[model samples]
Target: MTTAPHAETFHSDGTPDASGRRVGVLLSHGFTGSPASIVPWGRYLAEQGYAVAVPRLPGHGTTWQDMTTTRYDDYYAEIEREFDALRARTDVVVVGGLSMGGCLVLQLAERRADQVAGVVLVNPAVNSTNKQLLLLPVMKHLVKAFPGIGSDIKKEGVVESAYDKTPLKPLASMVAAWKQVRAGLGEVTAPVLLFRSAEDHVVDPSSARIILDGIASADVTERVLAESYHVATLDNDAPQIFAESAEFVARVTSQVAAS
Candidate 1:
Protein backbone atom coordinates (compact mmCIF):
# COMPACT_ATOMS: atom_id res chain seq x y z
CA MET A 1 0.00 0.00 0.00
CA THR A 2 1.15 3.49 -0.76
CA THR A 3 1.76 5.49 2.39
CA ALA A 4 0.33 8.96 2.68
CA PRO A 5 2.52 12.04 2.60
CA HIS A 6 4.30 12.92 5.83
CA ALA A 7 3.18 9.64 7.33
CA GLU A 8 6.59 8.01 7.63
CA THR A 9 8.15 7.11 10.98
CA PHE A 10 10.49 9.71 12.54
CA HIS A 11 13.43 9.15 14.88
CA SER A 12 16.36 11.12 16.27
CA ASP A 13 19.34 10.26 18.51
CA GLY A 14 19.88 13.22 20.81
CA THR A 15 22.91 14.43 22.73
CA PRO A 16 23.39 13.41 26.35
CA ASP A 17 22.22 15.74 29.13
CA ALA A 18 24.48 17.76 31.42
CA SER A 19 24.66 14.83 33.83
CA GLY A 20 25.76 12.56 30.95
CA ARG A 21 22.63 10.47 31.27
CA ARG A 22 20.74 10.24 27.98
CA VAL A 23 16.94 10.73 28.03
CA GLY A 24 14.58 9.48 25.32
CA VAL A 25 11.01 10.32 24.43
CA LEU A 26 8.75 7.96 22.45
CA LEU A 27 5.67 9.55 20.85
CA SER A 28 2.73 8.01 18.98
CA HIS A 29 0.03 9.46 16.76
CA GLY A 30 -3.75 8.92 16.95
CA PHE A 31 -6.02 6.37 15.28
CA THR A 32 -6.23 6.86 11.54
CA GLY A 33 -3.68 9.64 11.98
CA SER A 34 -0.04 9.16 11.01
CA PRO A 35 3.29 10.29 12.44
CA ALA A 36 2.69 13.51 10.56
CA SER A 37 0.49 14.64 13.43
CA ILE A 38 3.18 14.34 16.10
CA VAL A 39 6.50 14.56 14.20
CA PRO A 40 6.66 18.29 14.92
CA TRP A 41 6.42 17.57 18.62
CA GLY A 42 9.11 14.89 18.29
CA ARG A 43 11.33 17.32 16.42
CA TYR A 44 10.95 19.85 19.22
CA LEU A 45 12.04 17.26 21.77
CA ALA A 46 15.03 16.30 19.64
CA GLU A 47 16.01 19.96 19.46
CA GLN A 48 16.11 20.04 23.25
CA GLY A 49 18.73 17.25 23.16
CA TYR A 50 16.35 14.38 23.91
CA ALA A 51 16.27 11.22 21.85
CA VAL A 52 12.91 10.88 20.09
CA ALA A 53 11.08 8.03 18.35
CA VAL A 54 7.76 8.26 16.53
CA PRO A 55 6.65 5.00 14.98
CA ARG A 56 3.94 4.49 12.38
CA LEU A 57 1.39 2.02 13.63
CA PRO A 58 0.39 -0.92 11.44
CA GLY A 59 -2.45 -0.53 8.95
CA HIS A 60 -2.24 3.25 9.46
CA GLY A 61 -0.88 5.97 7.12
CA THR A 62 -2.48 4.05 4.30
CA THR A 63 -5.98 3.47 2.97
CA TRP A 64 -8.61 2.89 5.61
CA GLN A 65 -9.31 -0.56 4.18
CA ASP A 66 -5.84 -1.67 5.18
CA MET A 67 -6.65 -0.89 8.79
CA THR A 68 -9.42 -3.49 8.73
CA THR A 69 -6.84 -6.23 8.32
CA THR A 70 -5.04 -5.32 11.54
CA ARG A 71 -5.96 -5.25 15.23
CA TYR A 72 -4.99 -3.25 18.28
CA ASP A 73 -2.20 -5.66 19.15
CA ASP A 74 -0.60 -5.09 15.80
CA TYR A 75 -0.45 -1.37 16.38
CA TYR A 76 0.82 -1.71 19.94
CA ALA A 77 3.53 -4.18 18.98
CA GLU A 78 5.00 -1.51 16.72
CA ILE A 79 4.94 0.93 19.63
CA GLU A 80 6.60 -1.53 21.99
CA ARG A 81 9.29 -2.30 19.46
CA GLU A 82 10.27 1.34 19.07
CA PHE A 83 10.03 1.93 22.79
CA ASP A 84 12.35 -0.96 23.63
CA ALA A 85 14.82 0.23 21.03
CA LEU A 86 14.76 3.75 22.48
CA ARG A 87 15.21 2.48 26.02
CA ALA A 88 18.22 0.43 24.94
CA ARG A 89 19.89 3.57 23.59
CA THR A 90 19.05 5.97 26.44
CA ASP A 91 19.46 5.90 30.21
CA VAL A 92 15.75 6.65 30.77
CA VAL A 93 12.73 6.82 28.49
CA VAL A 94 9.48 8.81 28.62
CA VAL A 95 6.47 7.77 26.57
CA GLY A 96 3.67 9.97 25.20
CA GLY A 97 1.02 9.98 22.49
CA LEU A 98 -2.12 11.58 21.07
CA SER A 99 -5.59 9.98 21.31
CA MET A 100 -5.31 6.23 20.63
CA GLY A 101 -1.55 6.58 20.62
CA GLY A 102 -1.80 8.07 24.10
CA CYS A 103 -3.78 5.06 25.23
CA LEU A 104 -1.11 2.74 23.80
CA VAL A 105 1.67 4.43 25.77
CA LEU A 106 -0.47 4.26 28.86
CA GLN A 107 -0.53 0.51 28.36
CA LEU A 108 3.27 0.53 28.20
CA ALA A 109 3.44 2.56 31.39
CA GLU A 110 1.24 0.04 33.13
CA ARG A 111 2.87 -3.10 31.77
CA ARG A 112 6.47 -1.88 31.83
CA ALA A 113 6.36 0.24 34.95
CA ASP A 114 9.93 -0.63 35.91
CA GLN A 115 11.31 0.72 32.65
CA VAL A 116 9.20 3.78 31.93
CA ALA A 117 10.39 6.93 33.68
CA GLY A 118 7.36 9.11 32.90
CA VAL A 119 4.18 9.40 30.84
CA VAL A 120 2.76 12.24 28.73
CA LEU A 121 -0.60 12.35 27.01
CA VAL A 122 -2.48 14.74 24.72
CA ASN A 123 -6.24 14.27 24.48
CA PRO A 124 -5.85 10.56 25.24
CA ALA A 125 -8.90 8.37 24.71
CA VAL A 126 -9.61 5.27 26.76
CA ASN A 127 -13.39 5.42 26.97
CA SER A 128 -16.04 7.13 24.93
CA THR A 129 -19.61 8.09 25.74
CA ASN A 130 -20.84 7.97 22.18
CA LYS A 131 -24.08 6.00 22.15
CA GLN A 132 -23.48 4.75 18.61
CA LEU A 133 -20.34 2.94 19.69
CA LEU A 134 -22.39 0.63 21.89
CA LEU A 135 -23.41 -1.26 18.78
CA LEU A 136 -19.87 -1.54 17.46
CA PRO A 137 -19.72 -5.29 17.75
CA VAL A 138 -22.79 -5.84 15.62
CA MET A 139 -22.24 -2.79 13.46
CA LYS A 140 -18.77 -3.86 12.58
CA HIS A 141 -20.18 -7.01 11.03
CA LEU A 142 -22.80 -5.11 9.08
CA VAL A 143 -20.70 -2.17 8.00
CA LYS A 144 -17.06 -1.77 7.17
CA ALA A 145 -16.48 1.71 8.56
CA PHE A 146 -17.78 5.19 9.39
CA PRO A 147 -16.61 8.70 8.73
CA GLY A 148 -13.05 9.51 9.71
CA ILE A 149 -12.19 11.52 12.84
CA GLY A 150 -9.04 13.09 11.51
CA SER A 151 -7.81 16.66 11.43
CA ASP A 152 -9.83 18.03 14.32
CA ILE A 153 -7.43 20.96 14.53
CA LYS A 154 -8.86 24.41 15.24
CA LYS A 155 -6.12 26.19 13.35
CA GLU A 156 -6.99 27.26 9.83
CA GLY A 157 -5.03 25.85 6.84
CA VAL A 158 -3.37 23.18 8.96
CA VAL A 159 -4.21 19.66 7.78
CA GLU A 160 -3.25 16.36 9.37
CA SER A 161 -2.41 13.46 7.08
CA ALA A 162 -4.98 10.81 8.01
CA TYR A 163 -7.44 8.34 6.59
CA ASP A 164 -10.73 9.48 5.15
CA LYS A 165 -12.66 6.72 6.92
CA THR A 166 -12.66 4.95 10.28
CA PRO A 167 -12.26 1.21 9.90
CA LEU A 168 -14.75 -0.71 12.03
CA LYS A 169 -12.69 -3.82 12.80
CA PRO A 170 -9.70 -1.83 14.03
CA LEU A 171 -11.92 0.54 15.96
CA ALA A 172 -13.58 -2.43 17.66
CA SER A 173 -10.19 -3.93 18.47
CA MET A 174 -9.10 -0.63 20.02
CA VAL A 175 -12.26 -0.31 22.09
CA ALA A 176 -11.76 -3.86 23.32
CA ALA A 177 -8.16 -3.11 24.23
CA TRP A 178 -9.29 -0.09 26.24
CA LYS A 179 -10.82 -2.46 28.77
CA GLN A 180 -7.44 -4.06 29.50
CA VAL A 181 -5.67 -0.70 29.63
CA ARG A 182 -8.22 0.67 32.11
CA ALA A 183 -7.98 -2.45 34.25
CA GLY A 184 -4.21 -2.00 34.49
CA LEU A 185 -4.14 1.76 34.97
CA GLY A 186 -3.53 1.53 38.68
CA GLU A 187 -0.28 -0.26 37.96
CA VAL A 188 1.18 2.88 36.38
CA THR A 189 3.22 4.56 39.09
CA ALA A 190 5.37 6.87 37.00
CA PRO A 191 4.75 10.62 36.97
CA VAL A 192 2.16 11.60 34.37
CA LEU A 193 1.49 14.80 32.44
CA LEU A 194 -1.91 14.83 30.71
CA PHE A 195 -3.19 17.48 28.32
CA ARG A 196 -6.88 17.68 27.53
CA SER A 197 -8.55 19.98 25.06
CA ALA A 198 -11.43 22.06 26.31
CA GLU A 199 -13.26 21.26 23.09
CA ASP A 200 -12.59 17.97 21.31
CA HIS A 201 -15.12 16.65 18.84
CA VAL A 202 -13.57 13.22 18.34
CA VAL A 203 -12.94 12.27 21.98
CA ASP A 204 -15.26 13.25 24.81
CA PRO A 205 -14.28 14.16 28.35
CA SER A 206 -14.99 10.70 29.73
CA SER A 207 -11.55 9.42 28.66
CA ALA A 208 -9.65 12.13 30.51
CA ARG A 209 -11.80 11.58 33.59
CA ILE A 210 -11.23 7.83 33.52
CA ILE A 211 -7.48 8.19 33.16
CA LEU A 212 -7.22 10.74 35.95
CA ASP A 213 -9.34 8.63 38.26
CA GLY A 214 -7.78 5.27 37.55
CA ILE A 215 -4.05 5.98 37.44
CA ALA A 216 -2.17 5.57 40.74
CA SER A 217 0.53 8.07 39.85
CA ALA A 218 1.01 10.47 42.75
CA ASP A 219 2.55 13.17 40.56
CA VAL A 220 -0.16 13.34 37.92
CA THR A 221 -0.82 16.74 36.35
CA GLU A 222 -3.63 17.65 33.96
CA ARG A 223 -3.54 20.76 31.81
CA VAL A 224 -6.46 22.17 29.86
CA LEU A 225 -5.95 23.32 26.26
CA ALA A 226 -8.28 26.21 25.58
CA GLU A 227 -7.37 26.93 21.97
CA SER A 228 -7.03 23.48 20.40
CA TYR A 229 -9.24 20.52 19.58
CA HIS A 230 -8.61 16.76 19.48
CA VAL A 231 -5.46 16.99 17.37
CA ALA A 232 -3.88 19.53 19.67
CA THR A 233 -0.37 18.51 18.71
CA LEU A 234 -0.93 20.01 15.28
CA ASP A 235 -3.16 22.88 16.32
CA ASN A 236 -2.59 26.43 17.47
CA ASP A 237 -1.43 25.44 20.97
CA ALA A 238 1.27 23.16 19.51
CA PRO A 239 4.11 25.43 20.65
CA GLN A 240 2.91 25.17 24.22
CA ILE A 241 2.67 21.38 24.00
CA PHE A 242 6.21 21.16 22.65
CA ALA A 243 7.76 23.50 25.20
CA GLU A 244 5.88 22.09 28.18
CA SER A 245 6.66 18.50 27.22
CA ALA A 246 10.35 19.35 26.93
CA GLU A 247 10.24 20.84 30.40
CA PHE A 248 8.34 17.80 31.61
CA VAL A 249 10.92 15.40 30.19
CA ALA A 250 13.73 17.28 31.89
CA ARG A 251 11.97 17.38 35.25
CA VAL A 252 11.04 13.70 35.20
CA THR A 253 14.43 12.51 33.95
CA SER A 254 16.14 14.61 36.62
CA GLN A 255 13.99 12.94 39.23
CA VAL A 256 15.11 9.58 37.93
CA ALA A 257 18.75 10.59 38.15
CA ALA A 258 18.26 11.96 41.66
CA SER A 259 16.90 8.68 42.85
Candidate 2:
Protein backbone atom coordinates (compact mmCIF):
# COMPACT_ATOMS: atom_id res chain seq x y z
CA MET A 1 0.00 0.00 0.00
CA THR A 2 1.13 3.52 -0.73
CA THR A 3 1.93 5.47 2.40
CA ALA A 4 -0.20 8.53 3.07
CA PRO A 5 1.67 11.83 2.85
CA HIS A 6 0.65 12.74 6.37
CA ALA A 7 2.15 9.52 7.70
CA GLU A 8 5.70 10.78 7.14
CA THR A 9 8.12 11.35 10.02
CA PHE A 10 8.33 14.66 11.88
CA HIS A 11 11.41 16.30 13.41
CA SER A 12 12.21 19.65 14.96
CA ASP A 13 15.50 21.41 15.76
CA GLY A 14 15.06 22.51 19.34
CA THR A 15 16.44 25.72 20.64
CA PRO A 16 18.54 25.83 23.78
CA ASP A 17 17.26 27.46 26.94
CA ALA A 18 18.91 30.48 28.60
CA SER A 19 21.36 28.15 30.35
CA GLY A 20 22.54 26.83 26.99
CA ARG A 21 20.94 23.48 27.68
CA ARG A 22 18.74 21.77 25.11
CA VAL A 23 15.76 19.54 25.91
CA GLY A 24 14.69 16.80 23.55
CA VAL A 25 11.38 14.94 23.43
CA LEU A 26 11.00 11.74 21.41
CA LEU A 27 7.43 10.68 20.62
CA SER A 28 6.62 7.21 19.29
CA HIS A 29 3.42 6.13 17.57
CA GLY A 30 1.57 2.85 18.14
CA PHE A 31 1.88 -0.41 16.18
CA THR A 32 0.74 -0.17 12.56
CA GLY A 33 0.55 3.59 13.04
CA SER A 34 2.83 6.28 11.72
CA PRO A 35 4.33 9.50 13.06
CA ALA A 36 1.07 11.19 12.03
CA SER A 37 -0.62 9.71 15.08
CA ILE A 38 1.53 11.78 17.42
CA VAL A 39 2.61 14.72 15.29
CA PRO A 40 0.37 17.18 17.09
CA TRP A 41 1.78 16.20 20.46
CA GLY A 42 5.34 16.44 19.20
CA ARG A 43 4.70 19.78 17.58
CA TYR A 44 3.23 21.15 20.78
CA LEU A 45 6.43 20.24 22.62
CA ALA A 46 8.58 21.73 19.89
CA GLU A 47 6.61 24.94 20.06
CA GLN A 48 7.28 25.02 23.78
CA GLY A 49 11.02 25.05 23.00
CA TYR A 50 11.70 21.33 23.22
CA ALA A 51 13.35 19.42 20.38
CA VAL A 52 10.98 16.75 19.11
CA ALA A 53 11.49 13.63 17.00
CA VAL A 54 8.62 11.47 15.77
CA PRO A 55 10.00 8.71 13.60
CA ARG A 56 8.15 6.17 11.47
CA LEU A 57 8.88 2.71 12.77
CA PRO A 58 10.72 0.46 10.29
CA GLY A 59 7.64 -1.35 9.02
CA HIS A 60 5.01 1.31 9.63
CA GLY A 61 3.79 4.23 7.51
CA THR A 62 4.02 1.90 4.53
CA THR A 63 1.87 -1.18 4.14
CA TRP A 64 0.61 -4.01 6.28
CA GLN A 65 2.58 -6.37 4.05
CA ASP A 66 5.77 -4.48 4.87
CA MET A 67 4.99 -4.67 8.57
CA THR A 68 4.65 -8.45 8.21
CA THR A 69 8.36 -8.67 7.45
CA THR A 70 9.31 -6.71 10.58
CA ARG A 71 9.43 -7.64 14.25
CA TYR A 72 9.31 -5.96 17.62
CA ASP A 73 13.11 -5.79 17.67
CA ASP A 74 13.02 -3.75 14.49
CA TYR A 75 10.66 -1.25 16.05
CA TYR A 76 12.73 -1.05 19.24
CA ALA A 77 15.93 -0.51 17.27
CA GLU A 78 14.37 2.40 15.40
CA ILE A 79 13.30 4.13 18.60
CA GLU A 80 16.70 3.43 20.16
CA ARG A 81 18.45 4.97 17.19
CA GLU A 82 16.26 8.08 17.39
CA PHE A 83 16.80 8.35 21.14
CA ASP A 84 20.58 8.20 20.76
CA ALA A 85 20.49 10.84 18.10
CA LEU A 86 18.34 13.15 20.25
CA ARG A 87 20.49 12.53 23.33
CA ALA A 88 23.62 13.41 21.40
CA ARG A 89 22.21 16.86 20.60
CA THR A 90 20.50 17.70 23.87
CA ASP A 91 21.26 17.70 27.57
CA VAL A 92 17.93 16.39 28.83
CA VAL A 93 15.66 13.96 26.97
CA VAL A 94 11.98 13.19 27.61
CA VAL A 95 10.36 10.24 25.89
CA GLY A 96 6.68 9.46 25.40
CA GLY A 97 4.34 7.44 23.19
CA LEU A 98 0.91 5.99 22.46
CA SER A 99 0.07 2.27 22.83
CA MET A 100 3.01 0.11 21.70
CA GLY A 101 5.10 3.25 21.48
CA GLY A 102 4.53 3.53 25.21
CA CYS A 103 5.95 0.05 25.70
CA LEU A 104 9.03 0.88 23.68
CA VAL A 105 9.70 4.07 25.65
CA LEU A 106 9.29 2.21 28.91
CA GLN A 107 11.91 -0.24 27.70
CA LEU A 108 14.21 2.67 26.93
CA ALA A 109 13.63 4.20 30.35
CA GLU A 110 14.50 0.89 31.95
CA ARG A 111 17.80 0.61 30.07
CA ARG A 112 18.74 4.31 29.90
CA ALA A 113 17.51 5.58 33.23
CA ASP A 114 20.27 8.12 33.47
CA GLN A 115 19.57 9.69 30.09
CA VAL A 116 15.78 9.71 30.19
CA ALA A 117 14.56 12.51 32.42
CA GLY A 118 10.84 11.79 32.12
CA VAL A 119 8.16 9.70 30.36
CA VAL A 120 4.60 10.31 29.17
CA LEU A 121 2.33 7.52 28.01
CA VAL A 122 -1.19 7.42 26.58
CA ASN A 123 -3.16 4.20 26.92
CA PRO A 124 0.05 2.19 27.23
CA ALA A 125 -0.21 -1.54 26.73
CA VAL A 126 2.06 -3.68 28.92
CA ASN A 127 -0.32 -6.55 29.53
CA SER A 128 -3.69 -7.42 28.10
CA THR A 129 -6.70 -9.38 29.28
CA ASN A 130 -7.68 -10.15 25.69
CA LYS A 131 -7.65 -13.92 25.26
CA GLN A 132 -7.29 -13.72 21.49
CA LEU A 133 -3.75 -12.41 21.90
CA LEU A 134 -2.86 -15.65 23.66
CA LEU A 135 -3.45 -17.60 20.47
CA LEU A 136 -1.11 -15.42 18.43
CA PRO A 137 1.69 -18.01 18.66
CA VAL A 138 -0.45 -20.49 16.76
CA MET A 139 -2.76 -18.16 14.85
CA LYS A 140 0.18 -16.38 13.29
CA HIS A 141 1.10 -19.50 11.37
CA LEU A 142 -2.40 -19.99 10.04
CA VAL A 143 -3.51 -16.39 9.49
CA LYS A 144 -1.52 -13.66 7.85
CA ALA A 145 -3.51 -10.82 9.39
CA PHE A 146 -6.43 -9.87 11.56
CA PRO A 147 -8.93 -7.04 11.72
CA GLY A 148 -7.46 -3.57 12.16
CA ILE A 149 -7.20 -1.87 15.54
CA GLY A 150 -6.42 1.59 14.31
CA SER A 151 -8.45 4.80 14.58
CA ASP A 152 -10.06 3.95 17.84
CA ILE A 153 -11.07 7.50 18.49
CA LYS A 154 -14.37 8.76 19.82
CA LYS A 155 -14.28 12.15 18.17
CA GLU A 156 -16.10 12.46 14.86
CA GLY A 157 -14.34 13.28 11.60
CA VAL A 158 -10.94 12.40 13.06
CA VAL A 159 -9.16 9.36 11.70
CA GLU A 160 -5.72 7.91 12.41
CA SER A 161 -3.45 7.06 9.51
CA ALA A 162 -2.68 3.42 10.17
CA TYR A 163 -2.84 -0.04 8.66
CA ASP A 164 -6.16 -1.55 7.68
CA LYS A 165 -5.09 -4.99 8.89
CA THR A 166 -3.08 -6.22 11.86
CA PRO A 167 -0.29 -8.48 10.67
CA LEU A 168 -0.05 -11.61 12.84
CA LYS A 169 3.67 -12.42 12.85
CA PRO A 170 4.71 -8.90 13.88
CA LEU A 171 1.98 -8.90 16.51
CA ALA A 172 3.38 -12.09 18.00
CA SER A 173 6.76 -10.40 18.17
CA MET A 174 5.16 -7.44 19.92
CA VAL A 175 3.55 -9.72 22.48
CA ALA A 176 6.96 -11.19 23.25
CA ALA A 177 8.46 -7.73 23.66
CA TRP A 178 5.58 -6.74 25.93
CA LYS A 179 6.45 -9.61 28.25
CA GLN A 180 10.08 -8.51 28.33
CA VAL A 181 9.20 -4.89 29.04
CA ARG A 182 6.74 -5.81 31.77
CA ALA A 183 9.40 -7.90 33.49
CA GLY A 184 11.83 -4.97 33.44
CA LEU A 185 9.39 -2.23 34.53
CA GLY A 186 11.07 -2.14 37.92
CA GLU A 187 14.21 -0.81 36.30
CA VAL A 188 12.54 2.44 35.25
CA THR A 189 13.35 5.36 37.53
CA ALA A 190 12.24 8.32 35.49
CA PRO A 191 9.15 10.34 36.35
CA VAL A 192 6.02 9.19 34.48
CA LEU A 193 2.74 10.80 33.39
CA LEU A 194 0.15 8.43 31.96
CA PHE A 195 -3.23 9.03 30.34
CA ARG A 196 -5.88 6.37 29.97
CA SER A 197 -9.08 6.56 28.03
CA ALA A 198 -12.03 5.49 30.11
CA GLU A 199 -13.56 3.67 27.15
CA ASP A 200 -10.85 2.13 25.11
CA HIS A 201 -11.78 -0.47 22.50
CA VAL A 202 -8.44 -1.83 21.32
CA VAL A 203 -6.36 -2.14 24.52
CA ASP A 204 -8.01 -3.26 27.72
CA PRO A 205 -7.76 -1.29 30.97
CA SER A 206 -5.68 -4.12 32.37
CA SER A 207 -2.75 -2.87 30.34
CA ALA A 208 -2.89 0.44 32.18
CA ARG A 209 -3.26 -1.38 35.46
CA ILE A 210 -0.08 -3.37 34.92
CA ILE A 211 1.90 -0.25 34.05
CA LEU A 212 0.68 1.66 37.08
CA ASP A 213 1.28 -1.23 39.39
CA GLY A 214 4.61 -2.47 38.02
CA ILE A 215 6.74 0.57 37.28
CA ALA A 216 9.27 1.40 39.99
CA SER A 217 9.09 5.14 39.41
CA ALA A 218 7.85 6.96 42.49
CA ASP A 219 6.98 10.07 40.54
CA VAL A 220 4.08 8.72 38.57
CA THR A 221 0.70 10.29 37.76
CA GLU A 222 -2.35 8.90 36.00
CA ARG A 223 -5.24 10.73 34.42
CA VAL A 224 -8.41 9.45 32.82
CA LEU A 225 -9.49 10.66 29.42
CA ALA A 226 -13.21 10.53 29.84
CA GLU A 227 -14.04 11.83 26.40
CA SER A 228 -11.84 9.64 24.26
CA TYR A 229 -11.06 6.08 23.27
CA HIS A 230 -7.84 4.17 22.55
CA VAL A 231 -6.34 6.82 20.33
CA ALA A 232 -6.78 9.65 22.79
CA THR A 233 -3.89 11.49 21.27
CA LEU A 234 -6.17 12.33 18.36
CA ASP A 235 -9.49 12.21 20.10
CA ASN A 236 -11.56 14.58 22.21
CA ASP A 237 -8.98 14.81 25.00
CA ALA A 238 -6.01 15.54 22.75
CA PRO A 239 -5.82 19.10 23.97
CA GLN A 240 -5.55 17.91 27.52
CA ILE A 241 -2.73 15.57 26.53
CA PHE A 242 -0.90 18.29 24.64
CA ALA A 243 -1.19 20.84 27.43
CA GLU A 244 -0.38 18.47 30.27
CA SER A 245 2.56 16.92 28.43
CA ALA A 246 4.16 20.31 27.82
CA GLU A 247 3.83 21.07 31.51
CA PHE A 248 5.18 17.67 32.46
CA VAL A 249 8.27 18.15 30.34
CA ALA A 250 8.90 21.58 31.80
CA ARG A 251 8.41 20.45 35.37
CA VAL A 252 10.69 17.42 35.07
CA THR A 253 13.44 19.25 33.20
CA SER A 254 13.37 22.08 35.70
CA GLN A 255 13.64 19.66 38.59
CA VAL A 256 16.53 17.93 36.86
CA ALA A 257 18.33 21.26 36.44
CA ALA A 258 17.84 22.22 40.08
CA SER A 259 19.22 18.91 41.21
| Maximum-lDDT candidate | 1
Q: Across residues 39-105, which tens digit of lDDT does each residue of candidate 2 receive?
A: 9999888998999999999889888998999999999999999999999889999999999999999
Once superposed on the true structure, which residue ranges of model 1 sit more than 4 Å away at CA? none
Worst 10 residues of 1 by lDDT: 2-11
lDDT of each: 0.94, 0.93
Q: What digit string (tens of lDDT, one per residue) describes model 1 on residues 142-246?
A: 999999889999999998888889999899999999999999999999999999999999999999999999999999989999999999999999999999999
lDDT of model 2 at position 120? 98
Global local distance difference test of model 1? 0.94
* Structure candidate 1, residue pairs in collision: none
TM of each candidate vs. truth: 0.99, 0.98
Q: After superposition, how far is residue 231 of candidate 2 from its true place, in Å?
A: 0.6
